[model samples]
Target: MKPDPSLAQRNLFLLHHFHNDVAKALHEHMREQRRRGEIPPYRVEPTPSGLPTLVKINESQRIVLHTRPSPLAPMQAIAQELSRQPPGATLIFSCGLGYLPCALAPLLNRMKVIVLETDYDILLEALRMNDWGAIMPSGNLLLLAGKNAMEEANILISKHGSLLKNGIRFFPGRILLDEETPTFTSLQTIARESQEIFNYRITSNLQVKKGSYAIVAGHAHKELLSVLCEEAGHVNMDARPVLRRPAVTQFVQTPEMWWESLGRPLPAKLLTFTNKAFLPSEWDKMKAFGIRRFLWCYDDPFRATVDDTFFHHLDRIYCFDPFLTKRLQKQSPIPVHFLPEATAFSEGAVGPPPWDIPSTLPVTFVGSTGLQRQDDRLPRLVSSRDPSYLTIRQFVLDALAKDERIHYDELMALPVEFPNFHKSARVVLLEDLATFVVRLHFLAALVNTPAKIFGDQAWLEPALVGDISRIYAGRNLDYLRQTPWVYQNSKININIFNVQCVNAPTVRIFDVMACGGFLLTEYRPFTEELFRIGVELDVFHSHEELREKVIYYLEQEEQRERIARAGQERVMREHRFRHRLPLIFAAE
Candidate 1:
C-alpha cells in the first residue's frame, strides 16, 4: 500500500530530526567518555577503501578492522541486488567503500536503511568529502560511527525493529568478516542465525509464564549482587541476575551458547537495567528471546547525561533525582518518573554488631568529593585551555541548555578547536566545579570540629596540599559493610547531595536512615516531602549553619537519637526498594 503525501512528509521530517538527534547522541557519548577519563589514544589505519579507519592503540596489538577498496561507484549488479530486497529496513554492517549507499539510493522508495559503520575515519571522510546533506534528508538512511557505534546501532535497531524484521543485508568492511574480529564476526554469525535471534526475542515477548524467568543486569558484579538481593525478596517472578558482560552477551557473539548459559528457553517477563546502559544496545536482538519488559533505573542521572536513545523501547524509565526527572521528562515521551533510591537492613549478611564498638565515631562524612584531577576542567578541551572557574561554569550551563552541542558563538574569544562539546562534558564539568567548591567550603567549617572524612583515593586535597589534613580522616568506606557500620556508629552522620541534584534526596539519605544513623543532611525543596523536617532529621542551608547544627545535635544526644529513630522509621515504612515498585511497574 502506498503512503499518503502528508504522512510521507512527516516521515521525512522525523528522519531529518533523527539525523541531528543521533549525531548529538554519538557526540554526547564521546564527551562523556573523556569526562570520565575512559578515552584511550586512538590509532589511525589506512584501508584499501578510500578513507582511513580507527583502531585502539593497545598493548595486545589486535588488528581492529578489515576492508577492501572500491571506486566512486559499485557495479550495476550490486545496486540491483539491494533493490531486490523487500520493501523494509536494511541493517548494513560496514559503510564499506561508501559505494553501497549510492547504489542503494534508487531503492529508497521502499527501503529504510541503517548503516553501522565502526570506522570513525571513514565516517568523517564521508561527511567531509561526500554530500551528506543530500543523503541525510532522504528520510530513509542513517550512518553511525566512532566509539559508540555498536551501542548506537542497538538503539537504531530498537527504534526501527518493525522494519528490520524484513531481513538484514550486511556488508562487512576493513574489519573483515572473520572469527578473530568478534564484533564483525558477531554480526555475520547473527545474520546466519537471524531466524533464531528473531524467534527467541519474539518468544520471550509473549505473555508471562508462571515458571519462566526475568533477567537483571548491572554495570558491575557487586551492583548485580545488590539488585539481585533486593529483587529476590520483592518480585513475584523468578528473577535472575547475570553480572554485567561475558555472563550475559545479549546474543551478540553466540546466541546459542548464551541460551545454554541461561539453562533454559525461559521467557523474559522483565529485563531490568541499571541505567549505565548496562543492558547493552543489542537488546533489540534479544527481543525474540522473551524480553518483553524493560525497566531502566537511573540512580545518578545528573552525574552522567541521559541519552533518550537508550529509552527507545524501554517500558519504564525511572530516575532517582528530582532534577534529572524534570529535565528528562521534558525531552522524552516515555514518562521520566522520579523514584528515590531505596535501602533495607540486611541483618543476615552482616553478622553481629561490633563488640566494644565506640558509642560514636568522630563527626563523619562518608562520600567521595566528586572532583578527581585538573584535566577534568572544560578548558582542557578549549583552545586556550583556560581553567578559570567562572568561565567553565557558564560554558557548561550554556552547552547543556543547547543539547550539549554548543555553538562556537556562545563564548567570548572561544577557541576554534571544538566544533561542539557534548552536553555531558558540560554536565561533568559543571558537576565537578560545584562539588570541588562545595566540599572545600564545608571542609573549612569542620576543620575546628573533629570531623572524620571517608572518600575515594581521588580525594587528593586539603590533606596533602590544601593544609587541612587535621580533619581529613582518610579513605572511603565500602558501600556494603563499612558504610552501614559507619552510619550505625557515627554520632552525626552527614550527607551532601551532588550539585547536579540540588533539590532531591540522594540515595545516601535512605542508606543512612536504614542503618539507624543520626542524620544531618543538606537542605532541598523535596527533603521535607519525604520526611518531616525538625522531627526526623535536620538540614543545613549553609556551611556555617551546618557547623552550628552539628554542635547543637552533638550536645543534644537524646534529641538526636529521637530524630534518628524517626528517620529510620520513615525509611522502613516508605523508602525500601519494594516501595519504589509501584512507580516503575504499574501492576506492582
Candidate 2:
C-alpha cells in the first residue's frame, strides 16, 4: 500500500509540548551513540498495522517480531479490555508505536496510557515523519523508548502504581528474536521485565518483604517504624510507603482494587499514619478480602475526624498518648493500645556516627513552629461561613490555651445546632485552632531563655521573635535521620509539646532522652509516669518556671548529667521501640 499522506500527516504532527522534547532527546541520543561508535540495532519500516514503525528483525530478516498477527489486533484486544476499565485507570503497552496510545485516548473515559517502545530510533522516526498535532498531551498519553526506556518504565510503573485502580492493564506490542542474537534477546528481556512489573502491580496478591511483617507507613508515620526495624528481634521490618490521598484514590477506588493494594489473601496487617483515613469510606472492600487494617494515631481527638464510622473499619489502633487512647477506645469497638514515642535502646540499636563527636553543645529546641494565628485558620473554620462557629472556635481555643483536654464522648455536646457541625468541620477546626493558640503561648513564654529554636522561618518572624538567633535557631538536615545527632550534641534539649497534646508528652522527650541528653520540657500530666521529676528529666508548667529551670540546669551540670544518664537507662530498659511495638501488636 502506498503511504497515505493524511494518516502520515496526523502521525507526524507532535503534541506541541512534546515536540521539542522528542526532537532534542532523539538528537542527543543519536549523537552520543555516534561518539561511542555504538549504533542501536533498530531501523524504521511499515508494519501491517497500517502505520510506520521500527521493526526488530531476525538476522535472516524474514519474519516480523510479534506475539500476535499484527499490532492492530492487540490494539483491538486492549480497547475491548479497557472498555470495561473504570475511571482513574492506567494502561501500559510495550513495543507499540505512538498510534495505538492516541487511538485509545478517546475510548478511555479518563484513563492514562503509558507506552514503552524498544527503540528510540523508531520513536525518533515516528516523530520525524508523523504529525502528532492530533496527539494528546504528555499527561494523558506517554511515550517512552530507547536505552533509558527500561529505567523510565520502572519509574513510570511506580509513579502511576498508586493511580491504577484496575492494576496495570498491559498491551504487548512485539517481541524481538531469541537469545541467539544477544542484543535482540537482551532488549526483548528488558521489555518482558517491564511487562512483569505491571503484571505484579495489577494483580491482587501480596508482596511482603519480610517474614509476614511489612511496615506500611505514610508521610506522618514514615519515621514511626524506623527504630522497630533496628531492634535485636528476629523479625525483619520492611518499609512500604503508601501513596498520598490524591494518588491513592486512583489505585484503590474500587473495593477489589483496594484489596489488591493491601496484598489480599495474605494475613499481614497494614500500618500507616493515623492522620490519613486512607480508606475512610471503603472499609468494607478491605474486609471482604479478609484484610485487617492497623493504624498509628497521635493527634488530639478533636482533630481526629476520619469519618464517624471510621472506627468500624480498623482491626487495631495504636495511639501515642493515653488520652488519645481513651478517646479512641470510646469511639471504637476494636482494641486501642497506647504506644509512647520510642527509640531503640537494645544492644542492636543504631550506633553513633563513625567519628569523634561532641557529647554536648548549647541549649536548643529542635521542633518547628508550623502553626499560624487564628486569622490564618479562619477560612477553614466554621467561622468562615457561620457566626455560630465563632463561639465554638473560641471555646476550643481557650481550652487549648489552658492545655487542650477533651475525650471523644465530650465531643457529642458540640451544640448540635448546625447538625453537620462536628463531623463536617468543627471537630477538626477546634483541634487545629487549639494547637495554633497554644504554640503561640509556649514560644512567647520560652523566648526569655536563650534556647535556640529550629523550625519554620515563620516562627522567627518579627511578630514571633525579637532576637532571631537567641530564639530562632537555624534549621538542620533531614529531621528524622539527623535529629538523633542533633539531640546528642545539644547541652540541654528543650521540648514544648504542641497544644493538642499538652496534657501528654511529645516524642521529643523520648528522642532526646534516648540520645542520653539532658531534657527540660514543658510539663505534661503524663511526664511523671514516664520520668522522674528533676531526676530523669525536668518539667516546667509556667513561663517563669521554664526560664528559671533553664538557668538552674545551665548551672547544675552534675545534676543535668545524672538526669541524662537516668533517662537513657530508662529508655534502654523499658521504652525502646522493640519493647513498645511488640506489646501494641501483641494485644489480641
- For 1-588, candidate 2 gives per-residue lDDT tens digits of 244567544443333224333433454456446546786555556665555555554476744443333545655676777777675444444434444564576654467666666566656544554445544444455665555555545533443334443445554444444542464344345445545654675565543332234345432343444545455253343323343332233333444344334442343555555534455555565556454577777565445455456676778878777866776788777787877766643321246642343344568777654433222233333324454455554655566456545333444456534443334455555554444444555556556665667664445455443444357654433455666776776778888766556456676777788888888887777888877887898887765666777777888888888999898888778776667656554443
Candidate 2 local distance difference test against the native: 0.55
**TM-score of decoy 1:** 0.55
Question: How good is model 2 by TM-score?
Answer: 0.59
Instruction: Report the Cα lDDT for residue 74, model 2.
Output: 57
| Alpha-carbon TM-score of each model against the true structure | 0.55, 0.59
Candidate 1 Cα RMSD after full superposition onto the native fold (Å): 12.5
| Ten contiguous residues minimizing lDDT sum, candidate 2 | 371-380
- Cα RMSD (Å) between model 2 and the true structure? 12.9
Q: Scored by CA lDDT, what does every candidate get? A: 0.56, 0.55
Which portions of model 1 miss their true places by more than 4 Å? 1-215, 219-228, 231-237, 246-267, 274-281, 286-290, 299-308, 344-359, 373-424, 463-467
